[model samples]
Target: MRLTALLASLALAGCATQAAAPPQPAPKPAPVRAGLDPSFELDAFPSTYRPASSEPVAIVNATILTAAGPRIDAGVLLIRDGKVAAVGRDVAVPAGVHVIDARGRWVTPGIIDPHSHIGVGSSPGEANGDGSNESGPNAAGIWVEHAVWPQDPMFERALAAGVTTTMILPGSANLFNGRTVTLKTVPALSPQAMKVPGAPYGLKIACGENPTGGGPGKPGTRAGGMLGYRTTFAAAAAYADQVREYRRKKDAGQPAQPPRRDLALETVAAALEGRAKVHIHCYRADEMLQMIDLSHEFGFKIAAFHHALEAFKIAPVLAREGIPVVTWAGDWSGYKMEAYDSVMENAAFVQAAGGMAAMHSDNVMLMQHLNHEAARAMTAGNEAGLRVTPEDAIRWLTLNPARILGIDGQTGSLEPGKAADVVLWSADPFSVYSQPDLVFVDGALMHDRARPPERPRSDFELGAQRRPEASR
Candidate 1:
């Protein structure tokens, strides 16, 4: 009885306190905006990634695999003015040049990943943190660079693994996902500093199982997928026509009003204008062919078909059409029906048919072991009776991907007048046991095995608990 009375008293006191509280004011309504201006211009800016090094250096007594040509048994690679000054067995290193005696070491062009999600879909994979757009299937308004977290620790890890450059793409959750940004695997305060200067942006499009997302509204089948591409491209073309007419009339001094700018259609229009390259995620041969037809219908060429497992089945056609296939070696079987036809010799089959094949790592962990990934392809190719040399396999990781990114003329192979993006390996790069002893970007040593290289760590990694082995 006493406990019940005390409880009733407390309840009454709480009610009295609530009744004594003052009334709070309501929140003010936010002011509404008029609308966006149609005359506003979006800047198409060039990259400001200048070389930070001026010191001339020579890596001597190393076996160099110049991806552009034959391997040199004992080569001397000279780096001057942020470029590969020379690469030959008889190239003379001038006096006072910083010499790195790399006897018995192997040297090759820095690895380049044509497809990556390092900064956008970062490690520990949170959905909101990731850059995938699944709202309505079409999402060409997004740019991967805008979502890029420059402090992503994966950038440093990739650099450590000899990946000097990579193309960071938006995820394939949508039919027209977004634009891809090519980046130098160097730590920076912003994505702008990491971007590959003057590299053409790529539009990320997808077909097959990924974009379907199941159920209503989304592409429920392959037919729906093709329809999605056709309809979107058609709309983009119409929008482009409006914009073109507006500009023409304005330039001709005729009274005209500009069309309302659509960011998504603008990106697609950029691809049609050849200002952006098309990088599609496709699997089956039939779907790939349908996409090719759609590209022809839209007048935009597909620069590459990424994750094209069944590209081997249509290798000759792809080669004939001058399209490259970027795929993972030995990463297949039993995932989905689309990936069921995958074979370990897919890369070899494409190469045998005179098609360009590049090994790509869609996974972060696999990206760190790209050389091993190439070795797997090389082994599978050799077993399949294809005469693919180590140099050829290296090109899959370097020059071919560079060409896909449209940055081949700048830095792909250890060629004279190209950026000194090079890697020194502890052994043959095609060997599973090999590791990058040193990595250089634009003639500057970016990663060295001797000491802890100066690289940024994400805030999440800083001051965090690490295992004993991770400290070393």
Candidate 2:
């Protein structure tokens, strides 16, 4: 009996000691990123998200770009319920509204990135390999929304740079890589919380040599990538037809046979039905032309051609077809076989042809400097005598991409009845010294150099890396 009691007491002590020792702190939580990541909980839409506030927000005496007309001098914009309530030279300042003096500031819609890899833990290579391509020829069903980290530090940096909205996609290793997620840069612990309310869904497609792994032979060849895309879409169309028939039967009060579900096919069907957008990754002019045909065949619109290094060569045709090119300011590369024809005049040439061109950054580090990207494109345009004005360049980062993402009506410019996604520039945005003095997303002041947030690290960021003091 004594031995039994001692043994029981020993067990209790051991268990208590183990339990009280902190349990290894459960391993430090990774910084949450936005985009295709699933664990970050960004998927919590909860049926609806209404950005309403009791108080009104007002910005007075700022130069505003409507993104469709001449700059409004001495403009006043009022925001209520997280959207632009009014804007004009004649809007009266409401009594109970919060107002800011923007006497010498420049205000435009928050910058839009048609392509970015922010919010996902893209580093520590092995763990995040799933988020990128470098895989097989096709991973169409891999949805990147499963991988976004809402707390990604890039979100704040981009806010500081005037980026409020972005499309996060998986890498272009596969012909049909994954479904893209549009995100609003806000403090959403889950991916659901970060979604751009009412934003259209988009699927990521690639063409040219990108899917061929920049190598030789088979799917490692450009032709193979095209074949793979066409074949996959054909399969998706068949799959969608099967389901549509089932749905029709159910609606007709008949015995409806259930069809197998495929996430990949569902995304493709959404595009075919005009419920989704298609942003294809193509760097060459020829591939861009081919993709336009694919869109024609699939009965969908190609929203934009990402990283179209040779977009200028086909700008006229792209414009004629009403396709937008979200590309880098310059070729920025000449290494790949298809990329050999890239030129410094890509942006200028495209703009001259009346094609919609937007400067996009797929790099996490550059997402914040979209203005600089536009400026780079502007410089190239002017050097080529293309007459691309700074105001016009602003549209590349603002209105053009917004239209591509299908959010032009609500948050792309300084229009009344749009979301109050505004940016205040310290100088003319085209100047090298210009910086975002203030940034507002959805009517909330998110970045103020004079006052910053408590925690600025992204959800994907790990360890004790401190926010830059200058940034803070």
Candidate 3:
């Protein structure tokens, strides 16, 4: 009752003040009410501005690819406080927030590239490029993330291509190349803040042919490749044993002994302890099997097989053992002896055999068409009678890769409680001419082709790209 009385008193006071104000000259536009909302000032800009506070962003009238099974036509995807709050046809539009009209568009979880080389080296020309080890057999313990430059121009191109997430990795020239960094490719002002926080790292390892064949020495035979992997892992196992003994002694209250510093050996030690994920670059099925055994011997797990062109042959084995294969619909039979038998039905066959398969674009140019890649896989599957649904193909592009990258729970698919990383297509995504109209990351509208706009502008790309490139 006291609260009601106080409210009535305040209302009466307000009315009295308004009535007591002297009317003089009908002051210009009531001073525009500029101070009514301190956060937003009235301006001539038409593009929506994101305030530095928590607010829900809503996308209405779009088809959402949950990447599970059902596609919600004219669906609503709501992001509240930077995460997906609700996603469905029946979701009620919240009041007092921004609404993005997504009519006549397709919405899917952001494209995830399990194997990528976007930011590790921006300029892949002769002088500045150092990501791929064209040198020795194995260059372990070197983290490729440390060398990643946030200012890379490829980041913008990737994002414009509807890539919202990626696993930045080193090249496949070495047997145990280096540590790979998984991050959300959100464009920001700084690289330190651009990195995805607390994401798990992946270790790049090669087996079968590349390590043995591409090195400076004579690794021309498949037998040589097997030997190189085994020998490297064996040395790594010994290094791990040394580190373990030192830790044991220190724990027993004895004098601590520091082991000799070898950056190459530290990676193997980390792999043996299962702290880093092993992403072995291989193409043949037999080599993949050998690599799996090698992983078992090291007391670790093989996370995913990149470019596993022959993984369809071992789909049953991979499914039974729960290993993932990161490959694509188109990148088959282009280069090596191992790739001679590459098939168009690889991803579909893997999915058909109940094995996890993801589509990855290792090429900077190919990544621009990942959605088309997913569509191609679907079309190929339909033609081959392998019969994977469209949603299944979306899964390959989104959720399955997220699982391989250890980021499924955080950012793949249009789920109720995930990051609002989404791609808005200009047309039916299955059609060849479709382009991503807008891309959103963490509930913020990061890209819009229509806007003039608030996109990133890099120093070098000031007059180069259609979009101003910024760091993510």
Instruction: Find the candidate with the highest TM-score and give its number.
Output: 1
TM-score of each: 0.88, 0.83, 0.82
CA lDDT of 449 in candidate 1?
83
TM-score result, candidate 2: 0.83
Q: Which lDDT tens digits does candidate 3 get at residues 1-472?
A: 9999999999999999999998654222222233232212232112122322446888899888888659899999888977889989999987986888889888888899888887665743422465786657777766776666766767787888889888878887767788887766765544445555555667898776666665475366768767877887788788777767765654555654445656676676667777677888888898888878877766788889998999889989898878988997845685777788877788888888888999998877778888788888888888999897778888988999988878788887888788788888988776789888988888777777777354344444554555435643
* Predictions in order: lDDT: 0.86, 0.76, 0.76
Best by lDDT: 1
* Tens digits of per-residue lDDT for model 1, 1-472: 9999999999999999999999764443332222343334444445667666668999999999988999898899999988999999999889999999989999999999999888877765642366677767789988878888877778888999999999988988889999899989886878888888889888999998889857545788777878888889999889888988876765565666667878899889889989899999999999888888887888898999999999989999998888999998856666988888888888888989988989888877888999888888888989989888998999999999999999999998999999999999999988878889999999998888888744335565664546579878
Scored by Cα lDDT, where does model 2 land? 0.76
Q: How accurate locally is residue 382 in candidate 2, as Cα lDDT from 0 to 100?
A: 85
Write one digit per residue (lDDT tens) for candidate 2, span 171-228.
7766777778888876667777777777877888877656776643338667777787
